[model samples]
Target chain A: MNQRLKLFWAGVRAEFPLLIGVFPFGLIYGALALSSGLSATAAQMMSSIVFAGSSQFVTAQLVHGAAPGLVIVLTIAVVNLRHMLYSASVAPYVRNLSMRWKALLSYFLTDEAYAATIIHYEEEELTPASHWFFLGAGLSLWFTWQVSTAFGIFLGTSIPESWPLDFALPLTFIAMVVPVLKDRPVIAAALSAGLVALLAFSLPYKLGLILAALTGIIVGMLLEGKESPKEAL
Target chain B: MNIWLVMLLGGLITFGMRLSFIYLLGRFEVPETMRRALRFVPPAVLSAIVFPEVLMPSGKFDFGLDNHRFLAGIVAVLAAWWTKNTLLTILAGMAALLILQLVL
Candidate 1:
């Protein structure tokens, strides 16, 4: 295989585990969107148009409750603020790519794709073919999301409530994050973020997630800053 | 306000945020502190999501023994820590949650 294809498949392989988790998530989103009074076409289109998991779910709920258009739009913006952090995190590695490539990859920048691609980049850094891996991961996730959402729309509320399939997402995240906690600062960041998420769980529009992430990052940075002075003792 | 219009606006905003840094960083330098903080983004953000999902399965905190998701999450954490494998961790977590739900 050529280098690009090889890298692409490598990305697909790395992202396979997360796809298993996201597939069920997309299905639930589709089912929920329909039940929330969205038309079949609108619910399916949201998967492609909005292309976000959590925010799409929130939008469906608000629509069900008859929220105004401006309010839904505002809520979506808040819910998706985390993507900016994701954009920044992956920016340096893809800076050399063309504007078209950047736009394409940015469109694919879901949590699963970011996790898979970042781990690959941290290990392998930038290569001529690294962007292909990002493309592969992103495309595969996009395909899975669209298909699963369609299935969900077809089989609304039929999926058993007892299955606990959504737990796979958190498990996937735990797998991704735990391996990265290589130092005290990183550990502190994860713990702080987790604690804050719980404490701020009631926040509207999922703002707690952004707040918790910022708190964790600050805690990590502060501890790392103190590390040099502490080592001199 | 049509639903399609709402979706279009929301989608544009989302795509803009996703593109913002990637597009700007190519034309300008990212600050040193921002570069360093980026390293923590994965752990911090992923934990922020994972913690809430497991701890508040029903959108409320439940740390008691009967909170099977919390217990299952602990098992998944241990599995991930030990194996460092994504698939195994998910399988272990699902299994733990199933067994707990069945038993309790």
Candidate 2:
């Protein structure tokens, strides 16, 4: 097989384990979005349109309560702002590619894709085949997301309303976030964000979330700056 | 706004953010301070979102034993910190929440 195919398959292999976990979450999002008052079409489209898992779950929750569309949109943007970091991390590896390739890869970028591709990029130096690995990981996630969303929509119609599955969404976020609190800056950021969120919970349109997140980010940055000017410089 | 419109705009913004640094690389370098700041983005943003969900389930702050989500979330944090396993953390948290809800 060609080098690109080899890298693509390698990417797929690396992502396969992660997908097992993600598949169920996607299905849950689908069912929850529908039960939360989104039409089947809307729920399905959201899987592709927003593509970020946690944000989608949050959007579904807010929509269920009839929150304004603007709030949902802003929440989605904030939740996904971390993608910029991933973009920067991976940018150097793929910088040689044409604009078209960058555009295609950017569209496929998701947490899973970034996780798998970044590992590969770091482990194996950049090569023409490296982009193919990202393509494979991203496309797999994209395809699985769409299919799982559809399944969730179908399953949502049948699952009883009292299952309390909505809790899983937050649980998933905890799973993702808690493991990352490896150092003081990360811990401080999380604590500060959580405190701000509680204090600002009364804010309208879920603006508290944005404020809380920004506050946390700023806090974390400042703390890191204080700790290590060498690292910062 | 329609759901699709919201999604389209959200998707566009998301794509723009992701593309921004990728497109700008070499033309400019990310500031060192910002690079350090970026490391905190995931923890900060995710915790900001998660805290309110567990502590303020009904859009108001809740504390004490009645806050099952808060308790479960703590369980999740411990499990995640100890194990460093995403799936395990999620399962433990969900299970804790379910049991807590049942008991209370």
Per-prediction DockQ, in order? 0.54, 0.73
Residue A153 Cα positional deviation in candidate 2, in Å, after optimal superposition = 1.2
TM-score of each: 0.72, 0.95
Chain A TM-scores in order: 0.72, 0.96
lDDT per residue for candidate 2 within A48-70, as digits (tens), equals: 87788988998888888788888
The number of the candidate with the highest DockQ is 2
Winning candidate number (lDDT): 2
Candidate 1: the clashing residue pairs are none
Best prediction by TM-score: 2
Write one digit per residue (lDDT tens) for candidate 2, span B43-80.
Answer: 88888778888888876778878988889888988888
Candidate 1: residue A171 Cα off by (Å):
4.0
